[model samples]
Target: MTAGNPTPDTTAEPAPGPESHPEIPWERLSARMVWINLVRLVISVVPGVLATAVLDTPTGPAWPLLVASAVGVSATALACLRFLSTRYRVTGERVERTTGLLVRKYRYVPRDRVRSVDSSARLRHRLAGVRVVHIGSGEARSSFKLDALTAATAEELRRELMPDAAGEPEEEAGRETLGPQPGPHEEVIARFRKPWVLYQMFSVWAVLVVTGPAFGLHWLLQPFGVDLLELVGELVDYERRGFWWSLALCLAVAYPLGFIGLALTFVMSHWDFTLVRTTAKGHPVLLTRRGLLSTRTVHRDETRVRGITFREPLLWRWLGLTRTSVITTGLRQGPDEDSAAGVLPRVRMWEAREVAARVLTGEPSPLEAPLRRHPRGALTRRLVWAACGPAVVTGVLFWLGRTDVLPDRAWLVGVGAWPVTLFAAVFSYLALGHALSGSYLVVRRGAVNRSTVALQHRAVIGWTLRQSIPQRLGRRVTVRIPTPAGERHYVLPDASTRQALAFIKGSTPQLAAQFIGEAESGGRRAAPPP
Candidate 1:
């Protein structure tokens, strides 16, 4: 045979095929997920069965129901198995996901767009020798989940995906810690050191436990023709056989027990809790711990942070606990998504401020300083008008009762309306006072929900000062500042023309100059007066 030609016998001997692809270790969902799903299935089926039995539905179709449930469970189990059997191959350049029997899906997630990689192993998952890896990419703005990976494989995958490591001597490896390592500009400004477990349990009880049981009891008793208040009275009598004595005893026992449960839950939730600041591939990584349940690590691009807010809820204030969060661009709407967007786990308010100063602003501003706002009466009048709705409704109800247009038994309307009016008036006054108190508009805007609005001095994209028909009649103005990303506008519902102009001048001097220049140019173009 010629050098390029193969004989029939040579072809039959099997010519070299393309390079064999590496085998990807197939993985399944962690046993924990399986267990959790199983539990959910049981919970679903048991409730349906119980509900059917309670309603005395004909049992004729019971077999079908059972069969359907089993089929569903099997289908889900098979899907998870298929996922586990699927393998991902990561080369020096790209990540590829290949799977499916009849139909196949092959996706490539380039390494350059990957913003972060996270691996987690819950206690149950650890037992099952599985871990979940989350891969986040900026381009697609989505995250990929890889489950049931062996710990070693996870580490290998992480190493492969990690951005090119800074070339450092091998000797430096031994000095580095397993957790995040900070950059030169970043530091752990403060540590939130608390008896976390105690605090967590207390927080859980105070926030949720009491309300849950109270609501449950209220609902359960209502269905049985029982009144909660009456039942409570009876229980009180049973305890001491005397009304006053029983009341005192119940209060004494309930308060301490409630507090104990609160304390325990706090302890459990905050167990081994720690917050750390580190530079991950040059971005600030905030690592928080709250018990062994799971460890949450958040990474933020410092440039994307729009505002930092530190809040101390009334209850947590006493315990020296504070919640901190940031406002950032590209956030999805809704509290849950917003929470995922920029929320930091609850921490001491002071610590939050300190961290913000160090990471966001480079210098700490006093956390207690009151915010700035527009003139007081102007803002208050608008708030008062808004608050008057409830009062007006209450007044109408009271007038109808007094006029006997409604039954005399409805006299309670006037009595109830008194409280409603007082509440509305107080709220209106506070809202108005807050509006008028320029402190509310101060650059640092958040106490409970904090936001700071500041524009680069030279980066003003557009400025508009407008007055609506009502606002014009009322001599009020609304100021809008538009940036490339979006607009930040404020309504000064009541302000004179001069006051509005002056406010704009003080807030954005450059914007005022631009506006004045435009006005002067427009005046020049106007036809000469006759």
Candidate 2:
């Protein structure tokens, strides 16, 4: 009660705003963030510090080492202390952060705008016993992060930010979180399996997954005089020998080693994978936690989840394993956007479907629904690219070899690849499909990585029509749907103009409403997708 104000009316409703939630206050980042930053500083300074200490200067070896050490410590301590200036809070209406000492920067995201609550902890941060939290709203610049929070606090914040996850009240059920796994109250939808490891081990294309990172590391170390890729190239050089022999030798060495590396990585990364269903606020949320050394936790509000993608790579699809990822507005779409969005690693198709249904809160998964097959012209278009395209390349190489422009082996190589290309084209044609499944718009395509995505009808913002010279000649058009989630747009390639327009109209009426009547009245009305 204020001194002049007659004791504030006891029953008066709270004035509102910040006063409405007295429990929440501006919170500071964990002090251990200083340790995490210091570790990074030491790692950066050690090499230079050692080189300086090795030089015999007027300041002596010991003095250089000691002085460099002192400077590093001072700089790190001051820089990391910026955590002291940072403060954030979660109010009923917003998630706010305040930073900067002199100028004072304050920013807040409305509670409704928060899309995902993701938390991760690297090895050093784990050693310091802290996790970093990110609250993303699809947009890159608007994302807010909290670094170095206690594991428990990070989990609490994750729950607070994602209010739509459905679950029973913890107080009523008397549940407590244990270790890295979900508490007994949380329902786990999927987990790691040994067969997944073996499936990857037997994969003929595993070399790409294993060597991609090795090549990146080798590139980074090139300035340091490390040339691992060059060494590999020298070993596999085919200039002095038959290309076939060199190819065989390279395959022999890469296959077993690639298998072991990929399997080990698979085991280490997904040793304790778990996809759990939990509740926040009144809505349901999907929470996925995995990894052995560096743990990652992705908390996505069920409402923001626009769809699911079932991706089947060539070899994995043959091996009966499929990779599953969710399409959510909370996740930013970019080159590697789906990497962190994967809800399940490669697993049996049925297991993937079951988990999809569980997360989607439906008994019969949408993937089970029949899809409208593409017209024969689409298949003809694929055959031209798959068969004639390679045949044309082979003919060009043959002509070039006769003209002394390229080696005879180039044409021979094209001959050898023609059959495989044709086979792939046929498989891709078979996979081409699209349909409107109740509340979802389904589009499936791709040969190397056959991906079938089920997007919500309401998530579609608009439609785009594209046609190439060949497509125009064949009277076909490619339709792309623009959405805020996944890849800004999803594509339906080489469908008849009439059918594509019909699909557009079926998914979202207004976009195609203007085009449909004219298209149908102009020609024999296309049969509605069965």
Best by TM-score: 2
Q: How accurate is candidate 2 locally (lDDT)?
A: 0.71
What would the per-residue lDDT of candidate 2 be over residues 156-229, giving only the tens digit for each residue? 88667653334522111111121444334678788877787876577767677657877666644443455777
Candidate 1, which segments miss by more than 4 Å at Cα? 1-123, 129-186, 195-207, 210-266, 271-277, 281-290, 312-322, 328-355, 361-370, 395-470, 474-530
lDDT of each: 0.48, 0.71
What are the models' TM-scores? 0.56, 0.68
Task: Name the runs in model 2 displaced over 4 angstroms.
Answer: 1-33, 37-112, 144-185, 202-254, 332-340, 386-405, 408-417, 468-473, 505-515, 523-530
Model 1 quality (TM-score): 0.56
